[model samples]
Target: MRELAGRQDDEGHGRVLERAAEAIEQASGREVIPGGDGELAGELRYALAADVVLGATYTGTLPELHPGERLALVAVCALAAAMPGCVLGDLERELTLLAGELDQAVAAGRAATAAAASRA
Candidate 1:
């Protein structure tokens, strides 16, 4: 059961990374330059802010989260920090994806706890 939970967390983290990459790519139109200067800095800042806001909203909506969910959220924020651009469409998608993942994690955690309690 522990292993199963671990796998779920790992998968969730991977999804967050994957979605971040997709959002970044979409925002930059498949163009990601190296280093943080000028345009890069601006884009990075936008992405980081978006991530922070989205994560805060998620935590506010679901205050009761497991350690794994919190870790996943942090990973998502890190990924967002690496993203770029402030396109409204991409930002909306990013927020939507983050919220959806958070919801899924919370639901899974609740289900797991309920199942464990039932067994006990």
Candidate 2:
């Protein structure tokens, strides 16, 4: 089972994920299987769509979570959102490193886009 990069074994990272998962499940009224969707993707998509529609971050849709816990929840939701019609376990394992790189790309793109928009 491949773990996320920069996840130290002694840092209680797994506990963070576990708490986040429980919070997500409780708030969404859906089961969150780490490597499975269980229709949780639909809920996440809906939340994101709602965010876009409202032009605001909807924190109430999820329980109040610490920053680290929120990150874990976001990561788990991201994995679930991308799992549709794919082998969840394999994808999670295979994309471990690629995901980190993609995160960087995503952050860079966001910064670049925001900068360009500001200049325009």
Clashing pairs in 1: none
Q: Quantify all predictions' global Cα lDDT against the true fold.
A: 0.42, 0.39
lDDT of 2 by residue, 3-120 (tens): 2212324334333334333443443333323555434454445542322212223232333232343344355445434434233456456445445643654455345445655666
Best by TM-score: 2
Candidate 1 residues lying further than 4 Å off, grouped into runs, are: 1-89
- Give the per-residue Cα lDDT of candidate 2 at 97: 48
**Candidate 1 residue lDDT tens string, 53-75:** 13224333332334454444455
The TM-score measured for candidate 2 stands at 0.32
TM-scores of the candidates in the order shown: 0.31, 0.32
* Model 1: residue 13 alpha-carbon error in angstroms: 23
